[model samples]
Target: MPTEAAFSWPREFVWGVSTSSYQIEGAVAEDGRAPSIWDTRCRMAGKIANGDSGDVACDHYHRYPQDVALMRELGIGAYRFSVAWPRVLPRGRGQVNEKGLDFYDRLIDAVLAAGIEPWLCLYHWDLPQALDDLGGWTNRDCAGWYADYAALIARRFGDRVQRWATFNEFSVFTLFGYAIDWSAPGVTDRDAHLRAIHHVNLAHGLGVGVLRDLLPQASIGAIHNRQVVWPEQDCDADRAAAALLDEHWNRAFPDPQLLGHYPPQIAAAIEPYVRGGDMATICRRLDWFGLNHYGPIFAKADPQCTWNFAWGEAPADAPRSALGWPTWPAAFRDELIDLSRRYRLPIYVTENGAGGSDSVGADGAVDDPARVAYLRDYTGALREALQAGADVRGYFVWSLLDNFEWGSGYGPRFGLVHVDYTTQQRTPKTSFGWYRAFIRDARG
Candidate 1:
């Protein structure tokens, strides 16, 4: 364990919190916002936990000013949020929603007024249901549609927001949505999976080009969720599963986008979708690498699934968070160091935190000691990575408020502030104070 005195950061290091459009902003139908794939998925029976949907999630759509005030008081230097594709483009392409664009314009102005920089992420897995109707990322035309949407956002908010992320966690969405039935637009077909993989990479590269062209002064990057993968057992089958899972989960996105070639396991499989000059289009220059890591994952052979590998469990004795995710700060440390060496760009830990089942206590206080411990341990490892020469420039916690957590719905709380779903109240947890003080001391 590192002492508080040992954990120090440079003055230029950025500290922020991240939240997505679908996860936080409710008001799905208001302001001409059409249905997203997630909206459709939530309507399906037994898709989301407790049958909960994002219909009224935290009500951030109407209460963003209050959220910005909360962030100002927390003393963060930046706020990273996403724009809902369906909200901006309604049916995904032809028509523009001025009301939807106006909402973000207001939100961005409020954030800037509070003296906090805003990092705009274009996509966070909320594909317009209209696009999914046309086969979503499984079709190559989807990339061009995404680029047009990017141009609209750039022309509207480019002057105010200089920090841009093309997409967040590409592997997690493509893998879960296409290969497994765990996410929205769930389809378990190999061709669909391969097409999605190639088209998304193409979209990212196109989005990056658009941002660079429109916002010449902007800093651009794409967020990837990378974690070490381990086999559940010592057998050959488990090892093979772990290896393949690692390639898909870790190497699929960054390997192609940064290195200009797909991973060995996916190279031949995705070749059918590749055309002349496609590799060049998929490997645009990025200013930084955004990493959203929780911890290492364990893989086991599963003959029943489309990918043939299933999520395995950690040993019963390993340290874990309230959500049963393994708590290994060393893995976080190693990931930062390895990412720095591999990509050769400034790195930002865009999202790193734990999830817990927190409830407001009787005294009107949220005392989450586990969350504080998790942040402390992870940040300690982060400092170690810095000392070992990882070119890390920023660190943003997973979220600012506990909103919708995908298929798990609102069960896992990964927020520094606790949000009451009924009243839409925001209460800063004990970890919030810890982070505020930590940032103050480090930056001072």
Candidate 2:
């Protein structure tokens, strides 16, 4: 028998699945839409797995109504999706593309018609290629640029959209895309990373102000992947290394956004970029706090490094996802408890799901028992934290369908519903049925 999650929630809690535009909506050339950084990066040789460019991945751009129907059938209360920057302001600034905006207008309408609340995320790392030409996130001008874009969308969709988020996973976009060569705008500059950090936070602060002013009745927040920080082993160096990384990856954004300043450890490293009043702008009052946690990343000290730390792998004996992420539910619970107590805001598990080797079985249905188990364990742990007084308000699965998985491409599946890339067929796996039952049972 499957281990059912003994969890309950308030009647008004937000429950849904999360998806980003670049990952699922695959009409790269349609609607006068300008190319995003991911679109440009995908075409480069050896960038994505199987040379996939999301050119035709899942074709959700054309098939969103069917996808919305899936959400409705799953009995979820909300749907969180991102608006592609290039799709709205194709050039990322000047003229707004009416046709591109029309697509989202239709998507939000469909979601509303299905009786599902639309939780809109302003940016999800799909910066316009044109904006990349203008120094992208590293450019201080991006703060105003993003604020303008936020105002445009909040004005357009605020009527139907009940919840809003500034950006999804700030650390990932800055560190992976800027500091490392794995993601789009692929570069390896420490100074650029430091600069981009403050700029992105500035954009968030400005974006939050736009949402608050335009959508005063709606709840506003930002999604961050600030999970449990741990050391590689019981060693002084590793513990020290973990502290620095925790300061950078975990506290760097939220502290300034919530507490009005950076953690002392990395403050000097990024002080050059911190102009006057930037911290005040970053620490906007949020109605809720969005946390995306999978598991813990243990850090190890390294002498020859400027950052002085390296990402050490999780314990080998632990349950592992197909993407090799540690499936540690205790860490998930710890994070939920920590955030609820520290942030003092209604916590939402914005993105939490395991990446699995999902496939369409010979019988034509997808079988992903591991993902079902992963979700069960993690949510059970979330329930335990809630029972122990964590003010966790809701949980949204990482994705609704398997589309682009970023640098790892489409190889890792993180969706309850499996997507056959070739046929654009959507098959709800075992986890889908499990989630549906769980929601139905919890609500009842």
Candidate 3:
């Protein structure tokens, strides 16, 4: 059991919930919104489970006012949401979509009107199809294109949105989207994977520069899904394997953005696949580092792992999410300390939640005790890290509503509010009440 001491965080520690545009904002084809890579990918045969699409996801585009009301009632201090790139720049670049901008304008005002701060994430894996057609992240020119888009959005909305995130989970985009071929613009080529990672890192740094130039007072960072990596055994081979995995998965982006360099081992590993001058563009400074940590990974030496990557294993007895990810809050605290020591930048828990098989009880309540416990454990872990001297600043639960779950579609629920997709009804889960109380206590 976790302790509930008289622990208190700094008054300014942000407590909020997070959502992405594509995940919640339906109206995919409206307001000059062209197809994103996600849109195109979901329509492909056998791509998304249940053939689900975000065409009418959660209908947040239409019901944002209600959602803002929910946030106010929940007593959250801030909300972190992403801007859909395709919505603002229909063809990726060349023209502005006023209607699309108007949607966000109203949404931002609604959030502020409800007395809730709005944190904006510029990109959340919803790359415009036009950009993907032009080679996407694999193309070196994409870094410049993304920077221009960032400048445009920052210049337009930065006044109202004081906190900005350049990208959501950069490593996930490169790993699942390019290397593993599990996400949009999917391609399973190792060289493409390395190129995509470097280009995405460069795009983030360049985007930061643009945001800094445009919004001088705005706090900016990139959200990375970091994990504490450990060897499954004490053997030298397993330790070496774990080190290699850490160099790529853990140190790759943080070193570049925070320390102004990539880990030398990672640089050497991907050197032959790197294009000219990519590293220089990637190594830019950031004001803060956004970390989305859930659990640790137990890595073992696997000679057959791609790029000599270490194989990760979750103990059979460990609790698992609906997505089969292991639940390990202890690992979460360790990751926070490790990142604080390595980067020395204020960190935000940008996204952390567990998905489970949730159901609406006969009493008209969604009983999600598992999710409630998960949040409790993770929050305790976060507090532990703070007590241990991590420069932590905020926490944003993974989602506010259950919408499209990528390849899994709506099969997995990771929201405080349960959505009946068929009727478009929204109902807060038991975990929602617990979170509201948790926030109240934290604030107190």
Candidate 4:
């Protein structure tokens, strides 16, 4: 593999890291914050690995200043973080929590003081438990509720935050939470899944409009988790399964939001829920496309599953990450080129990193050669995509710290900085130094 010096990055290309609220901020019950659906899922037996929860993941709610300082030390140009909807709106709507809003104000101030730009993401799957009780995203009114929440965030943080993302990975939560019994407020019904899809898209469009109106100067976009879907076998059923999964996974959110209509397979089913001018309401102009690509996903037919498809395994000979995900940098390169051509918008690789089981060494240092190699190969592919006319503008690593990963819990560490869960001590990994140097060289 070529070294970092071999590739050239674009001028003004962004270099940063990202983290979500529930994954890191662990003041679950403090400051008048209410329960998100994930909070409720944590209490359910057998739902999460080791029965773990985000109750105190990274303790970032109380330790954000230290985290911000770490970003400055790494010379990161931008910091992408999400606001816990339940934290700001205790019931997900009506009655704002000043304390919750105040915490973010302090965080934003600290981030700016460190000379880093703040990119605020409106939602990161932490829907207030109160809202879930009222039908969650399945209900049509959920879109209005999300827009209201966006309005609150805009009015409070808009002055400081110029880059805003409406939602992070819209299809991931809706699919796992509604169609599969894998995530919070778990349900496995088709109608419920369709409703959630349309409602979330509607919410995103409405949120975009709100941000544009309230924060006219803000550069707004929505983050999507897109990946190539492949069949597990050569059989027709498996091929059919993969096709539908592709529509749901790759095109579901971006299609309606970008092209103003649902994909063919989803259009008929979702039409019932989409009222007059709902597509017009759900499609809004934006500044960029946030693409979160990890690795390609494999799907197989499953009669038992609600969607008639189940997650399949990658090829036996494929290179695998420590967490069992297939690691193929060519796919990353192709995805950027394809997304640029398909969307015709500036692309930002918002989340891309490898997860591993990392631990402090006998010498009190964390050595993660796999992560270092992964970053090198992936970033190299990013360069190839850019050179191929991908319209790529930026790339932000999946995370800065190993926080609570949903379902899999905290076992899979994706952080460039190692976090000692017991002591909350952050030790920069070998990849941390590598990324810092890569950023400096990329800028020059």
Candidate 5:
């Protein structure tokens, strides 16, 4: 490992950007695409901010060529994107949608033609409504359904798309969707949350097995968002609260995947709710682990808080993003280093970016220096972690363009390129130029 003073990425380091289908693809009902849970949820009253939806998000489904051109111009080596399940299996199981498969056929070809590798994520919370109506992630059978879908995608596009992520942020989807009722197919029952979590874990393992069987040479993995839970005070009570927070947020899903066992604390907490063999199903081995990190959580012992711990209100003097997340780069480095040591898997910064309110200036350019600073500082943190012996192989910025941000809608922009929703125009922000320059320097 390089020491702190001599830290730098390998010459072939992968520089990439990531985006999801439901967040960017749009054309929800076109080309034989069917409704996803997200589509159904956004139509519900008051479910999303400004009553906004991703019905026509950036028209990436129609304009991917231009997007690929942008990636090529930015000197990026890879593009991490998700495929919509409903797009491929319109009703989520029985029949395959040729049109849906064709769309991705073009997409993968476009990325390769641009000399960029396509990293495909099989699921990104856009489950087909047909599946959710029957049972969704809460149903064990959904695991088999997901595996079938994964098999189809791998057989169809595996030759071109060498990197595959089985699921994107399973904890977020399970907790927010079931426990908090803030995301799609919203349910607010703890039992449902526990069930969903189990099914998602099983799906990951089953999906990986399918991908490996079908695309034997492909690199298969999952993207899980891991956060550092720090106590507000060093007291025993505070430390205990922090431990619980960590079990729920960071270790719950990964522990099972990497170690084949749930955290003892989490298992005890949910013991009354768990059924037999659920833990074993979640302990699937993975080829790689994608770490989607943003900021740290400072928790305090609080019985009143939903999860038995509370995140103190945004600090009075700290800088925050449009999403109100603290701007802290140190957390990024620490989290990566810790995860690298604990998991012992090749790591990828699958997602990291701040949400900001950006607009095209009168000069026809977006001067997002704040975003530039965020990227620079965060990249420096990544370098620091590498110096400390983290086996990080790549960094994929959170987004390439501003698209739907789930419950928050499009209100918060987390893109290097600004998207004018009404006009569907893409304008590269100053941060985009900075990233391009960084990639050039890293390559040099």
Candidate 6:
């Protein structure tokens, strides 16, 4: 790793933290906020671990001023947070919730007043439950509904917020929710799975157009979660399986948006939904690329699997986060280099962090040396890519505080600051001090 005296980064490089609405803001039924698919999912028996829900998360909705103060103290240049879809449109369409909009307006102002730039994400898997009642993402009209919501928010706050992300991790929702029944609105149907992909692509492109027309000065992009996929065996069958998984997990989403067409492997499968002029609508030009990578995947051939590949289990000795995600720093650097070579857009490491089983000590310090080392190792690879001339403009840790971790509940913690879910107290972890000092020294 480079020392302080040997570091090289652009003067305007952004250091930030990312949080999704459903993951942190816990007021599920407050301020005219209608129920989201996640709320419904958490209520289903055997769906979540320990029967935990985001009903009271970190209570950030009621204590955002405190959260903003924490961000200001951390010395980050930006704060990326999502707008609750259900909060803004209680029924998903046809009516606006003024109270819901007021909440974000205040949140945005607080973030700006704290001297940090506000990066807005329009959707983060908290689809309004009412939309699920009407077919949700599988419905083709969802494209127009999302565009309408985008237009309303853009026309309201576009002047103050210059950066907007249309959606966050489309594959996680469609793959887990529609294909595997592991997430909200769970339905395991092959046809509905593919339909969700096409419709989300349409909604994103349409939302981009809406933002550009109403707020031409704004920067618009979508956050895509991608990683390298390696074959479990060197043989042709396993190689083909990994290729198929990569095509769907990695290339399928961005190819249509950036290259104006679907990958050849999936074109025939989704051709039924291809209408005239849809490609152009789905290929709207983005101002930048946002990547959310955890680690690479190893895939083995599996005929019974929906995608013809199954995630191979890691060896007993392999390094993993508390969440069991593999740790591969070299692959992280390669992802940056590959993305730079392929799309050549200004890149942002939008979501990168490791989850650990952290706890507050008797000394009142969260001495998570494991998490500190993880951040150091991962970011060392990031610096290597920067020196190799990747146009990386920003890097944001996966989160700011320990919040809800989806179906895993709150057991897996990925945060620079630790939050006591009971008392709602925020405690800065050891990594927080390391990052603050690193940014201070590097920016000097």
Which lDDT tens digits does candidate 5 get at residues 189-221?
Answer: 767877787778888888878887887888878
lDDT of 5: 0.87
Of candidate 3, the 10-residue stretch with the lowest lDDT total is 303-312
In model 4, where is the ten-residue run with the lowest total lDDT?
1-10
Among these predicted structures, which one has the highest lDDT?
A: 1
Q: TM-score of every model?
A: 0.98, 0.96, 0.94, 0.98, 0.95, 0.97
What would the per-residue lDDT of candidate 2 be over residues 87-122, giving only the tens digit for each residue?
Answer: 889999999999888999999999999999899999
Clashes of each: 0, 1, 0, 0, 0, 0
After TM-score superposition, what is the CA distance of residue 158 in candidate 6 from its true location, in Å? 0.7
Q: Candidate 1: which stretches are off by over 4 Å?
A: 1-7
**Which residue pairs overlap in candidate 5's backbone?**
none
Residues 33-129, model 3: lDDT tens digits: 9999999999898989999999999999999998999899889999999999999999999899999999999999999999999999999999999
Worst 10 residues of 5 by lDDT: 305-314
How would you encode candidate 4's per-residue C-alpha lDDT over 85-195 as one tens digit per residue? 999899999999999999999999999999999999999999999999999999889999999999999999989999999999999999999999889889989999999
Return whichever of 3 and 5 wins on TM-score: 5
Candidate 6 least-lDDT 10 residues:
1-10
Candidate 6: where is the Cα deviation over 4 Å?
1-6
Give the runs in model 5 whose Cα sits over 4 Å from its true position. Answer: 1-5, 232-241, 269-281, 300-306
For candidate 2, the per-residue lDDT at 318 reads 73
TM-score of 1: 0.98
Candidate 2 wrong stretches, greater than 4 Å: 1-7, 303-306
List clashing residue pairs in candidate 1: none
Query: Model 4: clashing residue pairs?
Result: none
What Cα-based lDDT does every candidate model obtain?
Answer: 0.94, 0.88, 0.86, 0.93, 0.87, 0.90
In model 4, what lDDT does residue 213 have? 88
How displaced is residue 162 in candidate 3, in Å? 0.6
